[model samples]
Every structure is written in C-alpha cells, then in structure tokens.
Target chain A: MLVIEGLTKRYATGDLALDDVSLTVPKGQVMALIGPSGAGKSTLIRCVNRLVEPTAGTIRLGETVLTALGDRALRRARRRMGMIFQEYALVERLSVMENVLSGRLGYVGFWRSWFRRFPLADIEEAFRLLARVGLDHMVDKRADALSGGQRQRVGIVRALMQDPELLLVDEPTASLDPKTSRQIMRLIIELAKERGLAAIINIHDVALAQQFAERIVGLHAGRIVFDGPASDLTPEVLTTIYGEEDWSATIRKAEDDDEDEPPAVEAARIAAAD
Target chain B: MDAAAAARAWRPPPLIEAAWLRWAVYGGALLYAVLALGTLEVNWTRAAEGLERGGRFLGAFFPPDFVTHWLEIEEGLLESLTMTVTSTVFGVILSVPVALGASRNLAPMPIYLFCRGLIAVSRTFQEIIIAILFVAMFGFGPLAGMLTLAFSTIGFMGKLLAEDIEDIEKSQAEAVRATGASWFQLLAWGIQPQVLPRFIGLSAYRFDINFRESAVLGLVGAGGIGDTLNSSLDRYEFGTSAAILLIIIAIVMVCEYTSGFIRRAVQ
Candidate 1:
C-alpha cells in the first residue's frame, strides 16, 4: 500500500504545485489522477516517487519512508516505482532493446550497463516484455524510428522491465490519437491487473480515465477537490475539478461508451485486429 | 476600400525611435571612417616602388627548388604531422572531463566555475602567443608546439561540448534518472548518445584546426613546417619557401576534405 500524508510541493519559484495532498492507494488498485493544466496532478504523482521532492509531507511506500531516505537508499526505493512519461521520453539514439534494458539499471553495475552486458535473466525478461507488447521484431530499431503508438509501447515495456510494485504513468496518452489513447489506457489497466501493481495515472481525458481506472482523484489549484469511484464523477464533480464548462457532452460521452461491449473484450478485439 | 488601403499601408517599425538620433549615428560612423582613412597618410610613390619590387620577389619564387632542401622539409613536415596527431589525441581525451564539468546541468557550481575559468584562460591567448611562451619555457622544440595546440584545443572543444551537453533533451535524461540509474549510468545511457554525433563532428573539426595551427606554431621556434618556411625566407631561398608554402596548402586542403567526410559520415 502507498500512503501519502500531507504531501506538499512548493517549487523554488514559489509555486505551490501540491498543497497538503493526502491519499492512500491500496495494493493492486489503479487510480487515475484527473486535473486541469497546472492543477498539480503531475506533481502529486512525482512526489510519490520523490521525483518532485515534497516541500513538507510524508510519502510512505509500504514500509519504506521515501522522504527520509538518503541518495543511495532513494535510488533503491525508486527501482520499485516505474514511471511512464508523456511524448514517450526514450533516448532517441538508443535502440528499443537498450531502452527497455535501461529499466534494469539499478539492479546492474555501471560497467555492466555501460557495456550493454545485462544479466541473462534480465535480458530474457526484456525479450519477453517486448514480445508481449508485439515489438520483438523492432528491438534493433532506434527509438526515434518508431511511430507514436509503437514508441509508447516501448515506453510501457521499459517501465514493466523494472518489475515495479507501482507504476507512475504521467500523461501516457496525451500525444496519441483517441483510439490509440484508449488502447494504451486499456493496456496499462490490463498490465496493472496482471501484475497486481498499484498505479497512479495522471490523465487529461476524463472519459478515458473513467473507462480504465476504478478510482478517480480530482486535483485543482494544488488541492484535492474530489476522490471517489469513477462512476461518481458527475457533471458537478467535474465542474468542481476543472471549473465551469459544458461538461454534459463529456459526461454523456462517458456514459455512452459504458453502454457498449465490456472494455476488456473490446480492447482484446482491437488488439487482435492490430 | 478602407481594408484594402490598410492592408497596403503596412510598414516595419523603426529600429531607432528617434530619426535624428539614427541620422546622427550614421553620420558619426561615416565621419569616423573618413578621419581614419586620412590618418593612414598614403604614400603613392613609395607604394608604387614597392609594387615593382614585389613583382620581382614573386618572380624569384617560380620554378620552386624542392630537391635542395628536401631533407629539412621532410623532417619539418614529419614533426608537424606528429605534433598535430598526438596533440589532438591528448587534447580530446583531456577535454571530455572538462566539458562535463563545465556543463551547468552536469556539475556543481564550484566545478562549473573552475572549468569555465580554465576554458577562459586557455582562450585568452592566441595560439602564436601561447606557442611563444611555451617555447620560452620548454626551450624551442616540438614539445612546446604540442603543448600549445593541446592547451588551446581544451578551450575550443570543452566550451562547445559543454554547450552541447546543456542543450541535450532533458526529458530523455530525466527518464533515465527515473529508472534509478546511477549518475555514471545516467551519463552513459542518457547523455552520451544524444551528444555523440555533435561531439564527433567537433573533434574532427578541431583536428583540422589543430593541423593548420601546428604550421604556425613553428614561427615561435616551436618545431613544425613553419620552421622550414621561416629559415628558407631568412636565407632568401624564395624557391624553397614557395615549395614549403605549396606543401602546407596541400596538407591543409587534405585535412579539410578528410574532416568534412568524417563529419558527414557520422551525421
């Protein structure tokens, strides 16, 4: 379980990105953090991993108190949390396999990582992850050579290679098309379920968040405004989170999607088609 | 009609807001140029006589005698080539750490300031001046020339490499760090690949520059092809001097072409 008590992140420029945000995510729970731009959703997730150091708060990932750890201990703690980024932040010049193997960097020595001499089991696991993502053939290709969806797949595989207990997915589908976004979201949800990993996915698309995540946390102006089941995200709640807008269309669209075939089956069918 | 007139009436804003100030600046520059020209005090008669003598000097250089001074020419050329290669290799090796330290994003404030200071010191003196000092200290040999070139190369390569490091895609490095990679691992996987192409191109360009500078280093008694050219000129051996000059030009051209090819290949 991940417990955050009074997590606050005030940047050096004096912007309070996260303000006294406290929440707990049970093991195997996938929570979607929905917020408007500058609403501190990214900061909240980054604080859990200590990527953005919390100004005044306690972040406890299971038994380990993340905020109190020294440099070496912090690195060891970070290995348990895999982070997926927006725009698929893969090293553009590195091969897909190298990018995937980089997730095991904490486990291996510097010389091993430098010479690309990863352990046998780690290499096998990387191959399996790539194959599972259907990117086994493109392993030799540079990260820059892949398409948007393909790069995101590589990013997902890289995150998974860490064998993390929690996945910190930040705007994973922001740059993707609507269909690809849904597919990636479904893939993340499925993977989280398969591994029993807790996840905090920061998303902009409310409807997608509703479809994939069981729980939703709404942040606004560095404060948590709403935290409830995905079904509880009504027009009023969205208005509270993202300010007054025509949310009827958004709410209606989410309802319309829910009435269709079960998301898992739909995702499987799409995967097969692909 | 009003819209059409408005569309046709656009003009860029004046750079200098005051028209009088702009005209005054222009007038001042023109006045300074005229005054500077007047200060030169041209001697037409002396210039004409010198031109005639220059024609004779040029005539003496033709049918260049390469056979007479081939041994010294060969030795000087060999020394210059060795200095260029060894100095370039040593300089590039030393530059890597300095470049890393100089990069603001990579190093702490004290290290960054120190590395930047080192680059500033190296860049303060021209190659010839450094060569003169090195020769004075090291007693007029290729050792001085090599040291001079290597010292200058650190500044040239380090500054550009640091700038390249600073401009690398931060998101890529951030992702690597998020993986819990150690600092060294982060550099290897994250930073190195992004800047490798630019680094290769710079090194090749620097090698070309060092080769050219090596010839000039010999003028200050730091051994190179310049030594042969200087001695030939001092002895009034115009033919031998012309031969050496031609050889230098050919070598420079070859270096330029090879470096260009290497850069293009890497990119």
Candidate 2:
C-alpha cells in the first residue's frame, strides 16, 4: 500500500502547488486523480516519487518511508516506483531497446550499462515486455522516429521494465487523441492489474477516468475536495470540484453506450443528454 | 460611427514615449558622428604618393616563386598541421569536463562560476597575443602556438557546449533520474544523446578554426607558415610571400570543406 500523510508542496517561487493532502492507495488498486489545470494533480503524483520534493509530508510505499531516505537510499527506493511522463520522455536519439533498458540502470553497474552489456535476464525481460506491448519489432528504431501512440507504448514498457510495485503516471493521455487516450488508459489499467501493482494516474478527461479507474480523487487548488468510487461522481460533486458549471453532460450514466463514437457525435450525444 | 472608426485606427506605440527626448537622442547621435568624422585629418597628398608605391609592391608579387623557398614552406606547413591536430585533440579532451561544470543546469553554483571564469580568462586575449606570450615563455616554436590555440579552443568549445547542455529537454533528463539512474548514467542516457550532434559539429568547427589560428601564430615566432611568410617579407621576396599566402588560403579552404562534410554527416 502507498500511504501519504499531510502532503504539501510550496515551490521556491512561492506558489503553493499542493496543500495538506492525505490519501492512501492500497495494492492492486488503480486510482485516477482528476482536476482542472493547476489543480495540483501532477504535483501530487510527483511528490509520491519525490520528483517534486514535498514541503511537509511523509510518503510510505509498503515498508519504506520515501521522504526521509538519503541520496543512495532514495535511488534504491525510486526503483520500486515507476513514473510515466505525458511527453513520452524517451531519450530521442537512443534506439527503442536502449530506452526500454534504461529502467534497469539502478540495477546494473556503470561500466556494464555504458558498454550496452546488460545481463541476459534483463534483456530477456525487456524483450518480453516489448513483445507484450506489441513493440518488439521496432526495438531497433530510434524513439524520435515513432508516432505519438507508439512512443507512449515505449514509455509504458520502459516503466514496466523497472518491475516497480507502484506506478506514478502524470497526464498520460493529455497529448493524445481521444481514441488513443482511451487506448493508453486501458493499457495502463490492464498492465497495473496484470502485475498487481497500485497506480495513481493523473488525468484531465473525466469520462475516461470514470471508465478506467475504480476510484476517483478530485483535487481543486491543491486540496482533495472529493474522494469516492466512480459511481459517486455526480454532477454536483464535479461542480464542487471544478467550480460551478453545467456538468450534467460530463457525468456518464451506467447505461450509457461506450462505443467508439467520433468526437463530434460524442460531443453531440453529451449535449443531447444534457 | 465616426467615433467607432476612430477607435479602430490603431498604430504601434512609439519606442520612446517623449517626442522631445527622442528627437534629442537622434540629434545628439548625428552631431557626434559629424564631430567624429571631422577629427580624422586626411593627408591626401601623402596618400597619393603611397598608392603609387603600393602599385609597385603589388607588381613584385606577380610571377610567384614557389621554387626558391619550397623546403621552408613545406616545413612550416607541416609544423602548422601538426600543431592544429595535436592542440585540437588536447583541447577537446579538456573541454568536456569544463563544459559540464559550466552548465548552469548541471553543476553547482561554485563550479559553474569557476568554469565560466576559466572560459572568460581564456577568451580575453586574441590567439596572436597569447601566442606571443607563450613564445616569449617557451622560447619560440610550434609548442607555444599549439598551447595558445588549445587554450583558446577551450573557451570557444566550453561556452557553446554549456549553452547546448542548458538548452536540453529537462523532461528527458528527469525521466532518466526518476529511473534511479546515477548522475553519470543520467549524463550518458539523457544529456549526452541530446547534445552529441552539436558537440561533434563544434569540435569539427574548432579544429578548422585552430588550423587557421596556427598559421597566424607563426608571425609571433611560433612556428607555422606565417613565419615563412614573415621572413620572405623581411627579405622583400614578394613572390615567395605570395606563394606562401596562396598555400595558406588553399589549406583553409580544404579545412572548411572537410569540417562542413563531417558536420553534415553527424547530423
């Protein structure tokens, strides 16, 4: 289980990106953090991994207290948590295989990694993960040469290569098209389940989060305003989270048809439902 | 309707808000230019006589004699080529650490300031000036020229490379760091790949620059083709001097093309 208590982040520039927030994510659970822009969603996940240092908080993953660890200990602890970026931050000039294998950097020695002489087991696992993601054939291609969806797949495989117990995904589908966003979200959800890993995914699309995540945590201006099951995300709850607006179209009903509808028609249907 | 049309008429704001101040600035600049030009006293008659002598000097350069001091020219060219290659190798080897330390995003404040200060000191003087000092200290040879060029190369390469490092995509490096990679691993996987192309291009360009600078270094008793050209001029052997000049131009052209090819290939 990942437990966070009194998590707060105040940037050096005096922006209070996160407030006194406390939450817990048990193992094998997938939670989606939904908030408007500047809602501290990204900061919350980053703080879990200490990518953004918290002003005051304690983050415990399983038995380890993450915030209090020293440099080397922190690095070792970071290996237990994988982070996925919105921009698909794969070393652009490196081949896809190298990018995927970079996750094992903490495990391998410097000389071995420098010479590209990874152990046979690590290479095998990398191949397996790539094959699972359907990117086995493109391992030799440069990361910059791949399309948006393909690059995100490489990013996902790289994170999984760490064999992490927890995944910190930041705006995973923010840059993708609607179909690709749903597909990527589904893949993350499936992978988390298959590995029995807990995940905290920061997403902007409310319907997609409701569809994929078991629980939804709504952040508004650095504080968690609502935390409930996906079914409890009523229009009134969304209004409280995102400020007052007509949110009737945003809250999907249980009987709503979840088909691969075109974006215009989907918008029209939501408008009609409203 | 008249008021609406007037409101729609938009013009860019004046650069200087005060009209009088703007006119005063322009008027002062014009006056300064006129005064500066007036201070330059021209001796037209002396210049006319010198132009005739200059024609005679130019006439002596025709029918360039490449045979009479061919051995000296060959030796100077060889010495310059050796200096260029050796200095570039050593300079680039030393520049990598300095570049890393100078980068604001990579190094701590003290190291960054120290590395930047080193670059500033190296870049303060021209190559010819540094060559003169080194020749005075080391007793006149290609060693002084080589050292001078290498020192100057550090400033050029280190500053440019640091700027490139500072401009790299932060998210890429952050991702690598998040993977629990060591600092060295972060450099190799994240920073190096992003800046490698520019690094190679800068090295090639620096090699070309060092070659040109080495030739000029010879004028200060640091051995290169410029020494041969200087001696030829002292002896009033304009033909031999012109031949050496032609060889220097040819070599510079060759270096330019080769460096260009290497840069494009790497990219």
Candidate 3:
C-alpha cells in the first residue's frame, strides 16, 4: 500500500501547485486519477516519485518513509517503483534490448552497468519481456526507428522489466487511437493484476478509466472530489467532479450514443471521428 | 454609459516605451563621433602622406631578391610547417581534457568552475602575447610557439565544448540518471555521445586557426618562417616577404581543405 499525507508543493515562484493533498492505494489495486488540465494531476504523480519534490509531505511506501529520505536513499526507493511517461522517454539511439536492460541498472553492479556488462539472466529477462510485448524481433532496432505504438509497447516492456513493486503510468493512452488505447489499458490492468503491483494511472479518457479501474479517484483543482467504485460514477457525479453544470451537453455532442454497442464498437465509432 | 466605462477600464498604459533608450543611443553616438573626429584625423593625414612613400618602396619589390636567401627561406618555412603540425596535435590533445572538465554536463561544480577559470585566464591574451611570454621562458624557439597554440586552443575549445554540453537533451541525461548511474557513468554514456561530434568539429576548426597562427608566431622570436618574413622586411627585400606571404596563404588553404575532409569522413 502507498500512503500520502498533507502533501504540499510550493514552487520557486511561490505558486502552490498542490495544497494539502493526500491519497492512498492498497496493493494490487488499479486506481485512476482523473482530472482536466491544471488539476495538478501530473504534478501529483511526479510528487509521488519526488520528481516534483513536495515542500511538505509524509509519504510511506509500505513501511519505508520515502519523503524524508536523502538523494541516495530516494534513488534506492525509486527503483522499487516503475514510472511510464507519456512520451515514452527511451533513449532514441539505443536499441530496444539495451533500453530494457537498463531497467535492471539499479540492481546491477556499478562497474557492470557502466560497461553495459549486463548479466546473462538480466539479458534473458529483457528478451523475454520484449517477446511478451511482441517485439522480440525488433530487439536490435533503435528506439527512433520504431512507430509510436511500437515504442509505447516497448516502453511498457521496459517498465515491466524493472519488476517494480509499484507501477505509475502517466496518461498512457492519451496519444493512442481509441482501439490502441483500449489494448494498452487492458495490458496495464492485466499486467498489474498478474504482478500484484499497485498501479496508479492518470487518465484523460473517462470511459477508459471507468472500464479499466475498479477504484476511480476524480481530481479537481488538486483535490480528490470522487473516490469510489466505477459503477458509482454517474453523469451527475462526473458533473460535480468536472465542475461543469451542463455535462450532458458535452456527452450529447458524441455522434453515436448507442448504449447496446460493445466497448469495441464505441471504440470503432470514436476511431471514425475527428 | 456602462459600455464607455468598461472600455476605459480595459485600456492599458502603454505597450512600447523607448524614450530613455533613444536618448542613450544618441548620446553614445555623439560622444564616439567627437572622439573619432579628434583622435583619428591626424593619424589619417599621416597615413595618407606615407602612402606615396610606401608606393615608391613597393615599386622596387617586383624584382624580388630571392637569389641571396632562397635556401634559407625554404629551410625556415619547413621548420614553421613542422612547428604548426606539432602544435596542432599537442593543442588538440591538451584541449580535450580541459574542454571536458569545463563542460558543466561532464564535470562536477568544483571541477567545472576550476577549469572554466583556468580557460578564462588562458584566453585573456592574444597568441602573440602568450608566445612572447613563452619566448622569455623557453629562450626563442618553436617550443614557445607550440605552448602558445596549445593554451589558446584550450581556451577556445573549452568554452565552445561547454556550450555544446549545455545544448544536449535533458531527457536523455535524466533517463541515464534514472538508471542510477554514477556521475562519471552518466557523463560517459549520456553527455559524451551527445557532444562528441560537435567537440570533434570544434577541435578541427581550432587546428585550422592554430595553423594560421603558427605561421606568424615567429615574428615574436618564437621560431617560424615569420622570423624570415620579418628579416626580409627589415632588409627591404619585399619580394622575399611576398614569397613568404604566398607560402603562408598556401599552407592555410591546404590545412583548411584537410580539416574539412577529415571532418566529413569522421562525422
């Protein structure tokens, strides 16, 4: 489980990006953090990894207190958590195998890692992960040579290679088409379930969040407005969470409102749209 | 009435203001114009008067006196060429470490500051000034010229190499760091790859500059064909001076072509 208490982040310019915010997730749970722009979603996710260090906070990862740790200790703690970025921040010049093998760098000896002398076991694991992601044949290809979807798949494989205790995905499906988004979401949810890791995702698509996560936490202006089962997320609740009065008008603008269609059918309709 | 009030509230004071700037530019220009008119007029008149005398002197230069000193000139030019080549190699070798140390990406704060300060001190003087200083220490030889070129290259390449370091992608560095790489490891893997091509290009350009500079370093008794050129000038052998100038120009052109070819081949 992860515990955050009284988290506050005041940047150098004295802007309070996150003010007294706190949230928690139990082990093996899929929790979606939903918010519009400027809701501090990305800031909150970065704060979890101390990328955006909080001015004041108490963060507990299981029994380890991460917020009070120094740089070295924080780095050690960060190894237990895998962070997947929206842009899939893999080194473009490096091959897929090298990028995945880099996931084990924290565990590898400093000398071995520096020389890229990855252990045979680690190399085998990297190849296995690549195979799992349907990129076994592309192991030697540089990251820049891959398509966007292939790169994201590689990104996920790299994250999985870390064998992390906690999985943090920031807008994983934001850049993908609706069908691809569903596939990515399914992979994330299924992988988290299989690994029994804590997965906290920041999602832009409401429907994807509702379908993929058992627990949905709605964020509005750095505060959680709704925290409950996905079934409890009604149009009225969405309106409250989004801070909009005529929320139905937004959903009504969708050309297809066929309730009987499968999720894939809805994905098809969205794919055909602008 | 309400609409008028809203319009009045919306108006800003001003977007562009240049009153003080205009006055400052005008005042500086006026001061420079007065100083130029006072200081340069006499010099210009003297230079104009000397032009006729220089033309008469140049008229005698066509029939060069290469007969008496052609062998000596060739020997000295060969020495200069050797000095130029030697200095370029040493200068590039010396600059690599200094450039890496001064680069903020590759070095820690203490090392970066120390190397940057050293480069600043080295670059403060012209190469001739440095050669003069070295000539006093080493007693009038090619060694002095080599030392000057090496120091100057360190200064020039160090500053440019640091800037190239600053321009690399932060994400690549962060990704390397996220792997929990040590400072040295991150620099080797992350910074080196990003800056290597540019660093090589800058060093090649510096070699070209040092080649040209080496040809003239002997004017300060640092040992090159410039010593011959100066001697020729003193003996009123303008034709020999012209030949030395032509040789220096030809050497520079060859060096330029060589560095360009090597750069393209490597990069």
Candidate 4:
C-alpha cells in the first residue's frame, strides 16, 4: 500500500508543477494516470521515490515515511520501489545478464558488486527472469544489440528482479508500436498480478489505460479532475480533462489519423476543430 | 489594402552588420604574415657555398655505419622504451582521479574548479619547455624526461576523459540510482562501462606520443636517443647520426601499428 498527503512541488523558477495533489493505491491494485503534456504526471511519480523532492508532502509506503528519511535511510527505502523508464535505461555496453544482476546492487556489498561477483542465488534469479521473458538466448549480448520490444522485456525483468513492493512505471509504451505496446502492457500487468504487487503506470494512451487498469485517475493542470473505475470515465469527464474538444470527433479522427503529419500541424488541426 | 499603404508598411529585415569587423580581422592576419616574412633574412650566396659541404655529408651517410655504432644506438633505443613505458603507466594512473574530479556532473564546484585549474597549468607549457625545467631541477637524466611526459599525459588524458564522462547518457546513471545503488556502485556500473574503451584507446595513443618524445629528450641531456644523436653530430659522424635517425623512424612506425591494432581490438 502507498499513501500520499497534500503533495506540492514548486520549482525554483516559481513554476508550480504539482499543487496540493493527493492519491493512494491499495495493495495488488493497478492504477493508471492519464494527462496531457506537462500535466505533472512525471513529477507525481518521481515524488513518490523522492527522486524529485516535494516542497511539502508526506509519503508513506507501508510503515516507512520515505520523505522524512535521511540519505542512508532513503537509499534503503528506495530499494523497495522499482522504477521503469520510457527509454529502457540499461547500461548499453553491459551484457543483458550484468544489467539484470545490477538490480540487486542495493542488497550486495560494495566490493562484491564492484567486481561483478554477484552471489550465485542472485545470478540464478536473473537467469530465471531472463528465461521468463524469452531473453535467455541473448544473455551474453550487450543491451544496445536488442530490438526495442526485446529491450522493454529486459527492462521489465530487471525491475522484477528487485523484488519490489511497489512498481512505478513511467511511459512504458510511449516509444513502442501498437502491438508491441499491448504486449508490454500485458506482460507488466500479468507479472504484477502474479506477484501481488501494487503499480502506478503513467500512460499517454487513454484507450489502453482503460483497457488495462481497473481504476483510472485523470489529471489536468496539476490537479486530479477525475478518479473512478474505467466504466465511469465518460465523454464529459474526458472533455473536462483535455479541454473543450469534441470527444467523439477527436476519437474518430485519431482512428484514421496519418502518422506523417508533424506535431505542429496536429496541434493546428485540433485548434481548428475546437 | 491600397498598394501605397502596403508599400509603406513593408520594412527591410535587419542584417548581421558585422562585415567591417570580419574585414578588419582578415587585414590584420595579412599584415602579420607580411611582417613575419620580412623578419627572416636569407643569404643566397652563403646557401650556395654550403651546398658542396652538404653533398659531402650526405655521401658519408650512406651504408649508415650501423655495424660500428650498434652498441651506442642499442643503449639509446632501450632507454627511450623504458621511459615511454614508465611515464605512460604513471601518467594514466594519476589521470583517473583528476578526470573524475574535473567532470562537472560528478564532482562539487570547488573540486571541479581545482581539477580544471591543475589541467590548465599542465597544458600551458609545451613538453619541451616542461622537460627543460625538469632537467634543471632533476639534473639532466631520464627522470626529467619521464616526469615531463607524465605531466603532459595528465593534461591530455584528463581533459578528454572529463569530456567523455560528461557526454554519457544521464538516464543510465539515474536508473542506477533508482536501484538504491551507492555513489561508488553507481560509478562502477554506470560510468566505468561507458568510458573504459575510450580510456584504453587514449592511453595507447599517449604511449606512442611519449615514445616519440623520448627519442628527442636526450637533445637536452635528459638521456635518450637524442643524446646519442647529438654526440654523433658533434663528432661529425654523419653516418652514425643517419643510422640513429633511421632506427628512431622504424621504432615509431612499429608503435603506430601496435597502437592501431589495440584500438581496433578493444572496439
């Protein structure tokens, strides 16, 4: 379980990224966060891990207060939370097995880990996870040699190797194709379900989030505008979250949208429709 | 809109407007070149008179006298090799910490400034000038040459190594941090893997440079092939001097090939 209270993050430039936001996730529940660009989605997730220090907040993971901890205690608390990145941030030159083994860095001693002398049990677990993701054949290959889908699979397995209590997934499907995105999403959900793990997935695709998550939380301009089941997310709620666009027309346009148009042209088309 | 009103509204765009500045720089460079050319004096008659002596010297250089000065050349070549190996090893080892300290992304502001200042001081003087100072202090031996080369290597390797560290993918390091890795462990996992191959290649290149410098270090009585060549020239033994020069060329070519092979293998 995770609990957050009165989270506020004001950057040094006086820009309020997150203002008085608060949320919670019961154990084994999958929550999807959906929002427009610069809607404070990333700031919220990073604040949970204290990667982005909140100006005023209290984050309690189970019994531990992460925001109140010191440097050494914060490091210890971080080991319980696993983070997946949009870019699949594996050390490029390291082999797939080494990258996986690095997930256990917090548990192992510095000298042992520095020399890459991971314990036999950790090594075995890494191999088993790699085999589960069908990457056993390429265990010796460098991270840069894998395809995008394969790399995401590796990222999932590495996060799982941490044996984390909470998974913080940031845009896991942003750079992936539709089919690959679905597969990655399915893999993460199934793994989390199997382990009875709690997860907060930051996603851009509303339909995919509705398809996968049991609970949906919509954010707008640094505030939570909607929080309910997928069935409760209506066109009116979507308009309130995304602004005054016609939801039905935009959904139809998205289905037939060509991929060749630049982002500026797309913005102009949206404005014209509005 | 009326045509006259549209024409009145139109305004020409602003230009860079620095053409005069550019022309002034060009003119200054041309004047400096002309003045530099005027400073060097040449005497054609004296040059002609020296041509006959040069021809005789060239004639004496043939067959190289390698068989006669073989012992002296062997000693000088060996000394240069020792100096190159020793200086490169010490220099690369010392450069690692300095490079890490100089990386703005890694070290605090004070440490970064201190490391950068040290690098700048080492790079301010040429290797020959540094060698001259060291020879004065250490008294004209191979110690002076090795020290000079090592100091220069710290400058070259530290500057490049800092750049390589700064250019690494930041997300990789952030991922490591998210895994609860300590700072040292983060460096071992995130930074070392990215920079190791470049570090090895640079060390090899520095070795080759130091070897070449060693051959000329003896010119200032710092002990190497340069000293042997200097003595031979002083005794008017053109044949021995030519033999030493050929040997130096051969060794340098061999080092180049070796360094290239190493860089390729590591990559």
Q: Which ten residues in a row have the lowest lDDT in candidate 2 chain B?
A: B3-12
Over 4 Å off, model 3: A173-183, A235-242, A249-274, B1-39, B42-49, B52-116, B223-243, B258-267
Instruction: Kindly report the root-mean-square deviation of model 3 from the true structure over all alpha carbons.
Output: 5.5
User: What is the TM-score (0 to 1) of chain A in model 4?
Assistant: 0.90
DockQ pick, better of 1 and 4: 1
Which candidate number maximizes lDDT? 1
| Cα error of candidate 2 at position B54, Å | 2.2
Local lDDT at B257 for model 4: 94
Model 3 per-residue lDDT tens digits across residues A113-152: 7688988988998887777667788999988899777777
- How much of the true A–B contact set does each candidate keep? 0.81, 0.81, 0.27, 0.78
Tens digit per residue, CA lDDT, model 2, A33-107: 999999999889888878789999899999999989888998898899999999999999999999999999988
State interface RMSD in Å for all models: 0.6, 0.6, 2.2, 0.7
Docking class for candidate 3? acceptable
lDDT of 2 at A251: 74
Which is better, 1 or 3, measured by TM-score? 1
- What value does the lDDT take at residue A268 in candidate 1? 71
- For every prediction, compared with the true complex, DockQ reads 0.84, 0.86, 0.36, 0.64
- Tens-digit lDDT track of model 4 for B1-267: 999999999877535347787778889899999999999999989999899878987888886878788899889888888899999999999999999999999999999999999999888988888999999999988899999999999998999999999999988888888888888898899899999999999999999999999988889888888888889989988889999989889989999999989988887
Q: Which is the better candidate, 1 or 4, if ranked by lDDT?
A: 1
Best by DockQ: 2
* Candidate 3 local lDDT, residue A261: 44
The 10-residue segment of model 1 chain B with minimum total lDDT is B6-15
